[model samples]
Target: MTDTSRRSLLGALGALTVSAAVPPAAATASPARATPSTPAASPSPATAATSGPRSSMTFTGTPYDTAAFARSSLGELTATVLPGTPVRTEIRHGGQRVAVLTKGARTVLLPGPERTFTENKQSFTDVFDRLVPDPALPPAKRLKPGWGTSPSGGTWSVYGGTSGDTDFGVHTKGAATMLLKDTEAGRYATLTDDGISDADVNCVAAFDKVPTGNACSFALLFGYRGGGAHYRARLSFTTKGEVDLRVEKVMNGETTLLAEAGPLATEVRAGDAWRIRVRRKGAKTQVTAWPAAGAEPTRPTAEIEDSEAGLRSGRVGVRGFASPGCTNLPVTLITGRFEVTAANWETPPSVTHRDWVRLLDAPFDGEWTPAVEAIVRGWAGSMAPDVFSYAMMFLPGAPGVRGADPRVAGADVLGEAGYGKPDSQGLRPVGADFHDYLERPWTFPDQTRRPEDGQRGNLDCSGYVRMVYGFHLGVGMMAVKDPAKKALPRKSGAMVDFAPGVRVAQRTGSGGSAPDLGQLQPGDLVLFDVNDVAGDPEDPDAYDVDHVGIYLGLDRAGKRRFLSSRKSADGPTMADVSGASTLDGPGIYADSLHTVHRV
Candidate 1:
């Protein structure tokens, strides 16, 4: 644990934007080259840089900028599921379509429209098959189709594959606990971070969910050599950039909230803990801090502070052990489980087309919406096919759901966005390695904007921030027009220049590398300037403000998550940015955290 100071945090709150420049390669490919801080290479997805299908998805009605792409293959699994219902999902990829209907897992066959119930062929149910048909091979070679069969004309067993980010064809729950192994990574994890090392690991916990927006959480307790060989237990979670909050401890349904390193708030004491009682009273979970536990002499008036994190989430989970920018000593997390309450968990109403659109698009600027919402919203939707599907890593239903907006109201937002699927290499958005991938062509966006903005163009440095938080209605006023745009004494009256609140913080940059160590906060905005104006993590330069990400809590493993606005890793987009893609990464020039604003 670490102790965070107050004054230092306050001084760190500045509202500056960075040059939106990226590396010559990053502008084209967003160069990201980082190594894990944990042992054996296992860390949080916050730091795992890779690419994914840039689907045309709106935020929780609220969320980035990237390129649009040709979504020729962006279909998803759909089921009119009931809460607490159990169902198996089967996906076929590469050249393979759907397997046989009611045969043994191994006795499956290809489907056809004119060819049903005969010739040992599989039964076809969906219409997509009749139109496009299977690739005459395995989808991704993930499953050992036809047993001992290789669609690529090989002798190895071919499993199905994904047109999305995760690959390798085979994914299943491990032994110790319900865990998913990437198969290629040679590591089985609860969070499925693809993190693995030969270091001495003791206990291992099971990752049930990856917080909001696909960022998973898991804990590890292991013994490693850091100064001296000792045993340390730490947690890990995904983060946007820095951090704002951390779940210190959860007991008897009560949780402790701590601002690990906030620019507006004080740092978290190595042993300091905030308590939260989980009793859903109305729209929020009632949480009160600093109560008289036993009998502490007199109740001092030092201001009992408390914070509330949505079960749905504002920025996924707060960054825990890993801050997306930290590379601390090694400490393994072993034997644990993750618990996540869905934000959009109750998704029944949105199950239908009309309800789904209204549930997300909020006050859309245009009539066009997206189809990816039906799938992505599952994380918080009223119904979860099964936590295991995501928590343990399983596939969605096969033959993928088929439907047409026919309304054209939002027909091919995904196709128009150019949301292409990833290769079988399990490509992440961050830099597992800079400038590379395993499949499909990827190009960064020229400009990024709000799909709901009703207008188009890129979001300037500060504008990026205003737009991101703008998703939250009452977050503040700076979300729309700059408060500084107003007259003198522009304090509370203007959302332009936020006075000094207790938590929200920001930073901006225009040149030179970011600041040196001695400075960094959990939820501080990271603005950078890579090529010209400024950018954030998406830039190759030290201070590029053209991008933005949220600060998530850490995990038991201590590997940080760095969420950001990418160039659709695979194509062009409307505003050049959209959706919240949580990848593995860290902050830049820890010192570059310039302007800190607390609101």
Candidate 2:
């Protein structure tokens, strides 16, 4: 999964709309800007994107037939990556040219416009036959005479046809349909097919009649190794419209239940389609089912871990069971369609990166201006992400703002680091008062009464912003020489009034004032009043504000997510470890949002 050519730079929160006191060890590198430019050769249209919210779609196995599954799933052919070393092919479905395949090399050359593929500067001219050979599928056969047309090019093996009255056929209703009927007791029907070990199987099925007394069962069977030895994930319908799910291991003629999900809340009718999926990877298998028309549940219904070597790999199929009392009803189960795919299927970046590009195109009232866009571009072109990630690095037993255990007398770790108590200029924490006793690289300026780290700096919220803008980007203010204007005071509250940056948004309230997101953009400084501190009449702008973070763009759920260094996570994180990086709704700092600045 490692790509050596990835050169995406870290975009810090836009530009320094304000200034802070430069760190003593700040780098003297010249500030860089993201000027407009174009690549030498335009990349082909992207085939897929990765920005979609998490999906429930699971695969049956990998190294399976891509062409057959692609046709079966009816999903657009975005891109395909053949896993290998020295030679791996990444084929983008559209466009004339495909990317090169070689050891430690990826290049695309103009191979003369004849729908050619390039590899190591060599032209694979019009060799579609060599490029995409029809893959060899596993051996299979249809046992019954009227089993109907299998859309998978006849790759299916029939089983459990001892009773002559059992029937099977394909109808025109779905992508691939199986029609089943049973006429006698203990009579069942099954359609199986061979595939790789790790796989994903999905289908929609329903019964023609409700169970009155005897239970009617349908199952998606996997790990089959010949006559009757396999794992089956079954759904049994009973007398009261209730459905129970079970995972069972069958050996010879004996059946053993592995896992069971008691009756579910969803009720099934005569023609209701219940979409079922079976995903088996290594020793773990998961089964999920829901109404085909409804949203898929986030969690699996039944799961099992079978490490038995005897049932590790096998074919997958569908099975139906019936009793003599249900003969007239024929115990009908209609499976409308089936789709199978490899376990490791994913899209390329250029496709998904377009999602953020599209988001930038969205119109926000006072946001999304040309100047703001340039600043955002500059931030992305900078080393912001890398520096931020460095600050987030884990350092076990690292000293932080909270000096040490007070139980141990004179346990003043910060005092040992040469930091002193705060002075009269601003609301600054003494060395010992600023820490949460967490393991993080927390460094602040010497004037802020913090440590001078020879290693990675230990940073608080405002200290982190200062490090990024002042130390890393080299646009920060110098040390204070006058009392008239403080050099970016070393506190979140002080930044609001003293930091020389554009105030993006501010609201004065008791608390619970969320910023108007439409007026905000990526790279903006997001400030918060975590404690709802009592306001100060003398210093209106700097009062109440106590925390700060950098704004990232919208997440998959379209929520405005930001990045911050904090005590709860013991480092920096955009994830919901303690609370999400969002401004409103159930997050920890959601109600504490106070003001915003562009720095």
Candidate 3:
């Protein structure tokens, strides 16, 4: 993509707050023509004051001053707007120009190109008011409680229990601590603070006597939105030194277990401190525990992603619950640290192979016809620019060869081949290595060779289509009753021959070729015979289907466009038939457009 196009896409990340007073023609009509213009005069000090905020000023003159207007507009929005840097407050795309400004978590866009500038009655305050941060609220800073201090002057709120004499106070000895103990059976006590939405609470806890026969537990509570709804990460200790870590959600007097870990074997002595940590953010929750003196475990004891029951923001705290038999048992919890912060939004350098596979399996949930939907899902799932690898095709060697190991081919021909890594917008450049890999012919090993001997990481045009459609729709391009008894095929011709749901829609070049381009929809398979060595066009047996692509509907210009992994500068790209070249030459449109298949 061009730099202008990329900038346009990036600007879309911020919410678009188009001025309501903008002229209908400017807002909805086609692109306006760019006319030559004279420089605009700078406004005087008195005139600038009456123009409301300088950021909301609109240049309204016949001969528009593009340069001066950009400077004045950018100056009001940001203090760091440099003249020549790429990070300049102003961005231009084709004939249109926009000024981008950011303050704290809010971003604002001001449209320009003085000649076509409309009266923007919208104020800067109005735009900022609509800006919503990702988490909606900022995270609280890490907190340390004062030792031997009461909950009255501190951040915590201590509540006395109604069931029995509950001791809810701080015990300051070696460290400042918050302790909660209940003597009554079937009663609970809590020490809470509403300072955080998403956070991690680390503390050490000990039971004076482990509960026997009845339940006794200490828990970290989050998403406490009152009305009996909250999420809990609990540690249940038994007299036998068994500890069970669990995550639960309590809503409307009902408790749902989200996740659980083992009744871990450990020595439980009186006052033996067990370090516990609970981290909750977004839809994910995790809990971990270990001996206070030992090193913390790398993995969490219990973790869950409960989008349905997960809470976004609420009061976070600690609580203790007791059953009938555990009346007199005292559970002590001492705080070490409470840290609440926003989740990282940056993308990692690379994702795992398993994660890459999950991207390929993303479901297609569009509101189109089933056939179209299948194809749309297939296409959407297969486009992963960050994870780059050469296309490889399955090669079944020899006919009627039972138990023959299938091999793959394509990567060897293109040296230094690997998956392409994309930028922030999931777009990767078509480098020299990718172009070299695509220029080779499809090849496969003979029946005697194993799959390991063939190219390791590669996929071709047909192979890509097959992998997506087969995995999602259960429709295979290369159908076989028993693969062990026969060799695998690699050519697009072979795929079309065995594709179960495919039917020929049109055939070009010879006998009768008339394709209704308007009838085409996204996901339709477009096949081509790149080599026209045979004379007969109508005869399917005469030509081999050397290339194939999936129709992706029309472009903004109403031209029919198809996506294909081609031997071009842009590895996998969307090409319009109106501007697409033929196999052997630079001619617009394909020379031997053999068949269009509805699959």
> What are the per-residue Cα lDDT tens digits for candidate 2 across 1-599?
01110111111111110111111122221222121121121111110111111111111232112332122222222334444322333323254222222222111111111110000000001000110011222223222322332322122445454544335433232322233344333323333323235556665677878866466777777777764677888887775677888888988868898999868644667677676677766777778877677876777787788845766655666777764455435556766555443221121001001011111211122322354334333322122223222222211111222112332222211100111221211112322222222123333332333233321223456655554444333333323211332234556776776664446567755654566655464556788888777657886444677788776555555566666655433333454423556776776577777777654
The whole-model C-alpha lDDT of candidate 1 against the native structure comes to 0.21
Candidate 1 lDDT by residue in tens digits, 276-368: 112121222222122112222122111112322222111111111222332331212122211111111111111001011011222112111
Which candidate model has the greater lDDT, 1 or 2? 2
Candidate lDDT (C-alpha), each: 0.21, 0.43, 0.38
User: How does candidate 3 fare on TM-score?
Assistant: 0.32
Q: For residue 478, give model 2's deviation from the true position in Å.
A: 78
How does candidate 2 score on lDDT?
A: 0.43
Stretches > 4 Å off in candidate 3: 1-154, 163-166, 173-198, 212-215, 308-310, 341-599
RMSD in order of candidates: 28.7, 25.7, 28.2
Best by TM-score: 2
What's the number of clashes in each of the models?
142, 22, 16
